[model samples]
Every structure is written in C-alpha cells, then in structure tokens.
Target: MSLSFERTQSVGIIGGGPGGYEAALAAAQLGAEVTLVERAGVGGSAVITDVVPSKSLIATADSAVAISEASDLGVQLFATSDVGRPLAPQIAINLAAVNRRLLSLAGQQSDDLRGQLVDAGVRIISGHGRLDGERAIVASTGPGGTDFDRIEADTIVVAVGASPRELPTARPDGERILTWTQLYDMKALPDHLIVVGSGVTGAEFASAYMNLGAQVTLISSRERVLPGEDRDAAAVIEKVFTRGGMTVLSTSRADSVVRDGDGVLVTLSDGRTVSGSHCLLAVGSIPNTKDLGLEDAGVQLTDSGHIQVNRVARTSVPNIYAAGDCTTFVPLASVASMQGRTAVFHALGDTVIPLEQRRIAANIFTAPEIATVGHSEQDLEDGTVRGFVHKLPLSANARAKMMGVRDGFVKIIASEGSGTVIGGVIVAPKASELIYPIAIAVERRLTVDQLSRVFAVFPSLTASITDVARAMHIVGSDDES
Candidate 1:
C-alpha cells in the first residue's frame, strides 16, 4: 500500500524523542500536517534524562580526571595556605553545582529541539498520548485530567521510548536507593556507591562515579562487565576500573537492595551482603508500551513488550508505525532518529532505506570510552560470518603516548577474501569520536586496502584506525603473494 499525497495528510506522533521528533520533522517536510505528543520535554530521555544528562555528568568527571593528571604534564597545583606546616593539593567536587549544570544543559537542549520542531511547522502537544484506534490518538492533558484532545491522522507513529526496569526485589525510593535518573538530585557525591548490573549503563556510571572520587563497587552477574561488548574492550575497561580503585564483583548477582539506616545494603543471591552509602540500579530498560491501547488497535508486540516492526518501521496495522526504544532492540538515539525518518518516508510514499542494525555505531561513555560498529569477534567465533581480525593497541599510537593513555586498543574485522571492513571496535579516551571513520568504512563496504589509503592526521588517535587497516591490507597481500 502506498500513501496518496494528492491531499495533505495529518501525521500524529506519540512521543517527542529522537524518533518522534525526527518523524514529525520528516512528515512536515513531506507536506504533512504533524502533531507531536510528548508527556515530558521535547527530545525525550536522550535530551532530558538518560543520554544527555548521563553524558554531561561523565564530561564533568572527565574534567576532574584531567585536572588530577595536570601535574604529570608539568603543571603543578599547590596548596597556597601555610601555617602549621605544608598543605596538599586536592580535588574537590561540588556535586550540587555539577548536577545543576547537567540538568540546565539538558533543559537547554530540549528547548532548542522544541524550537526547531516548531520552526518546522510541527504542532507540539504536552500530554500522555495513546492510540485511540488505528488512525486516531487521544491525549490526556493537565492536572484535572478532564480535558482531552482527540487527534485524527492518516498515519500514526509511536516512539514513547523506554524506562529503567525495576527489579521486583528492589525498587527505587529516589534516595539512598536510586535509578540512574535520580542521581542528579543528590546534594553531595556518594561516599561509597554500589552499582548493580554490568551492562553499558552500569559500567559508564561506575566509571564516572569512580573518576568523580566515589568508592565504587560494580556487581556483575556475568563473568565480566559489558558481556555484550567486545571481549578485549571489556577486559581493558575492567582493568582500568580495577586499577582506579573500583571493586568489581564478577559472577555475582544482586537479589535485592534494602535501606539500612543511613546507607543501603545489597544482598546477593549467594546470601552475601554489600553495604554502600548509595546504590544505583542500571539493570536494564522496559518498553513504555503499557496502557497505550496498542493491542486494542491491532499493534503486535514482542513477548518482551516491544512493538514488533518491519525494517521500514511499519507495525501490524498498515497506518501505524513504531520506532526507537519502543520497537528497536538496539536503543541508540542515532538509530532511533534514523528509524523515525524511515517510518515517515515510508508513510509519506517517499523512497526509504531500511535501518541496518549491524551498521549502527554505539558507544559506552566510560572514562576511556568503548565504541563499536558492524560485526564483532563473538559473531566471528559463533560462525555467524567469516572475517579476519587485526588489533592495534592505543599505547602504540603517538597521540595516546602524548596523552599518557596506555589502556585500550582498536580492533578491525575484515572479510577473508575481499578484505572489506565489516566491523570494528575502539577502546580509548574519546573513542566515541574515533569510531565514525570505521562506521563509514563498514557502511560503505570499504576494503581494508582502500581504508588504509585514506590519509589520517599524524599524532592523532585516528591514526590507530588507519594503522589497523594497513596491517590488515599487508596481511591480505602476504596471503595473495
């Protein structure tokens, strides 16, 4: 079925996240009347709570780490006061101010996105929106809950996003026991923070808090942190985390967390207990699909409650679509935006390119960030595909040496015969910035030899990427010779 653009069609979007906002903009550009319904601020959790706030906090922690190492660069920081002998230079964190700035930045970003959507001629509605039917949405607005707006549209896009999953045994009280979002309200840094779960969220928060001068204990149910990430990258991060005085408990699971007077106690399934001033729950996320009248509207959802969607973001109902965390398993904001745009294009009868999950790039915002794109070593081992691996340590890079970075490496995977770069992983400081070229290489099907031919800046972290590609090229040459 194709959309008839003979007349102006209305597009109703439920959620104002990357997915919803992007879809709204795309639909507007396609000459469709768009109305975006968002219960929170525009830009969703990416701008308001989850991605932007967390990354901003990590940025502050990164600054603190840089300052602590300033003396190593011959920039001495000394105590100025003297009376009863000599004083020592110390790093002090004003967590209140830091959190305030984080929230302020997030708020500003949300406002900017809202302004952009407004300029694009998309109507913004502040309320909880649900599917009234296949082609209509009902928005519940205001404190009284009596006023409601019924919006009818030719196409409906759901991008309500997801929320932090709460364990049945332990629920967040927003105080000593908290989810990641509640951390910004803290007046002071946690004295001893216990982070539950070892996924990307947990690792990032654990690393950030440790750098922020908090004693951290990371509890992982798996053999290592980031069980889903590249093994070498996870190992390097674990090593850095341990070397930085953070305790890592592997192969241990937290059964529950309870308030213990002034602190919190996390009990493991093995009957062991861990006490900390605060506990951050980063177990995972649950799709925000409940009470949305989705099933009633004939929308199919996965067993895990995610909206089942096609590559073009079509739901079971032809006129209805889903994107972002609401439908995608890989919940990166960039992917969400792409999926949203794809949905809008398909709905408006425009040519569309479906999102390729394998080509999606994701980053863990730890001190030495871990970023990856395309295939992984695990996939190769599982015989999912054929590839050759080449690794280059960051220590071997001139830029890493100048920055005193000895941890992390860049790993690339290429096809056996063609030597096309299929995937790559980068673990280093600012790895997020360095992974883009590799992502482009993977997406564009650039062979290792072709990637090596691209000029990279001297004394730069990106040099490591080209170096790995060049090494792979030489290996391929040797095999041919």
Candidate 2:
C-alpha cells in the first residue's frame, strides 16, 4: 500500500526525545492524527538523565562554590578551633536529598510535557517502535516472544535519541564503573572519582563531583581539558580545576579499566594506571540507529551509525524523516525541536527553512558556564568565514568585581569588512543566559556599532557587552590604519 497523508491520515513519531515530542505537537497542530511511540519516558536521554539532571547537579555545585567566596561579602566563618575536629564547612549537602530532588524535577518536567501532548490530542504508546516496512511500524510490548502489534501511518519520524557510548574495555557495571546516565541513582558519594575523557561531559562530571566534596582525577587524551571548546576558556577552567584540588592528567589515554577489590583502576595507553574509588566513562554518544529497519526501508545512515538526513530532516525515502541525536546534526535539545518542526513544515509543503547551524547557540553548564554563538577562530582559519576577534575580561566588569569573580572573559568576532557580528563566546558565571543576546546579534548579522548603541546597565556584568563593543572601535581603527 502506498503512503499518503490525507487530512485524516495518521503520522507516527518514534522516540520521545525533544525532537519526537516537538514533532508530534507540530503535526497535531497541523490537524494530522498523530501517534507517538516511546520506549523510554517522554523526556528522552537529555531531559531524563543527561541535560536536566546534570544541570541541576551543577546548580548545587555552584552553591557550594559560592560559600567559599561569601567571605568577601562581609560574611564571616569561624572554623572549629578544637583539636581533632573537622575544619570543613559546617553546612553539608545531603546527597540523598539532592538526588531525590533532581529526579523529582526531571520527572515533573517530563510529566508536564506529556500532559501538553495529551491535551493536544496525540496518542502516546509505551513500546519499542521499529519500522516493519515502508509506512508501517511494528511495536512490541513486554519482553521477547510477544506478538508485534502493527501501527500504520502515512509519515514516520525517527527521533530515537543516542545513548552513552561505552569503551569496550571499560564497560559500565552500573556500580564501580558507571555511565553519566547512572550517576543520578547514586545516594552515597564516592571517596575518589576518576573520570575518563576530558570532553564537555567528562569535564562537567569531574567538576560537579569535585565540588560536591569528592576527590576527583580527570584524565584527558588531549593537551588540556575541554579540548573541543575555546582554547582560552579551556585554559581558565583547567587552572580553576587544578586550584580547587582536582588532579588533571593530560595527554593520557585509558587503554582499559578494571575493577579491583575496593576501587577501579584505569590503565593508560602508556602503561600507567590510575586508581580511584569509582570511574566514570564520558567518551561521547552514539546514535540509536540500529535495528529500526533503516537499511531495509531505504534510509541512508552515516559511517558513524547516525541516520543520514538532509537539512529539512528528510531521509533517503521520501515518506521517511529523522531528527535528534539519532541523526548527524548536533544533538542538542534546541536543535532537535527546530529540526522536528522544520521536518513537519517541509513535509506539509509549508514554508520551511533549512537548518542554519551558524545561528544556533550552545552552552556548557559547568560551574562557570561556557556559551558560544556563531563562528569560532578555527572557523575563520578553516576559510569558512573571515572575522575580527576582540576579548573583554570580566574582571574589569563592575558586577564581576562586586561578585568577587576574577576569572572568565567574553570574546566577540565580527566580519572584518562588514563589522557584522558573526560569532561570540562568553565564559562567566551565567554565560548560558548571557549568550542569548549575542546569539540574536549573530542571527540578525547586527553590526558591532549597533550592538554598542544598546544601553547596558552600569555596574552589571552586561556592561561587559559594551566593553567588547568599545574594543571593536580600536579594532576598526587598526584595520583602517
């Protein structure tokens, strides 16, 4: 039977990640009968385990860090002068309470989203959804040997998000060796934690656990932590981590990880072993593109196991589409939602714009968040675009001085000839929130002069934006002279 989406035709979306749910909402709004099949909960990996829980954990970590800096705000702390007594802070976090609250929040968000979907007239099902054939899905509930139920829809969306990638030798036992997804289940903190891979996820977990009073050792294959981020920002965070008693090992690769009697040992490629009470593997994520009959259904897949899709999220087959972490596009919640909406628009013959990666803003929710918008210095060197770079230190900002912050800075890059802001980076306490304005500038191609014309509150960290804008004047003069 041929797949045809009539007014009363049903549309099926697999995986309940941001992409899947958002697409369901869009399709339902367009008056299409929608069915969403989810193997896990509605929030997917990002909302349930990865992004939301980790960020909530980082919030607690930030509170812990703030206590140390509270002294400058005329707050005094009297250390216990008694002998054989602990000098650590009197207020301690209850790991159990924190974990419970984190899970509760994640569940709440998931429930709220599910409620909205239900109210919007989308049918939700709990089962493993797989492509039975073109325009057909076979979903099985319970364990193996169950009869596969059939779900036929004119259009099918594959939003099956990725799972945490595990190294072969250091596979997670869900106890001594754990993935980031399993960390929220922990009630007791590890005495010492060895985090393998110094990418964004690894660095974030290492920093979070360290702030929560665990001794941490971060192993990086590259020369520095956060190797994929801005170089200067990486350097600043490395210094902060080292100063805060984190053991950072660079240029080291773990060959294998094995659990010993009471701890885990990670042997490096150079034959050196790192021992700790627990080990976390944060290598990266692999797309969940296997066993969905993609090969049989005529959908192309990347060499790295990601589903191959065009800018509008169209698969090789005209009737099929894919989005979220399952695809090769950057696996972000924001990007996933946009892709989902765009996929539906393009499918419906509505006005649809292909995804523009340059306009997307990304943030790393570490203690001091790292947010980036637009092009990078490497982007310019790669001949993707040409831009001028200007950096403004946050230390000079009145608000930063008042807050007792000495680290972090903001850097903005603009096209040399047009003075149009193309990209920017913010490394500060709330860089995640701060990056929005810069993202707007990048998306609109706002000129540096236009950005400078906006009035910024005096004595606030937002003043840093003006500082960067003012520096552009110097850059402009140097360009002319």
Best by lDDT: 1
Total clashes for model 1: 0
Write down the lDDT of every candidate, Cα atoms only.
0.92, 0.87
What is candidate 2's lDDT per residue for 153-224, written digit by digit as tens? 888999999999998899899888999998877778889999999998999988898888899999999999
* Each candidate: RMSD: 2.5, 3.7
Regions of candidate 2 where Cα sits further than 4 Å from its true position? 1-6, 77-88, 143-147, 474-481
TM-score of each: 0.97, 0.94
- Clashing pairs for model 1 are none
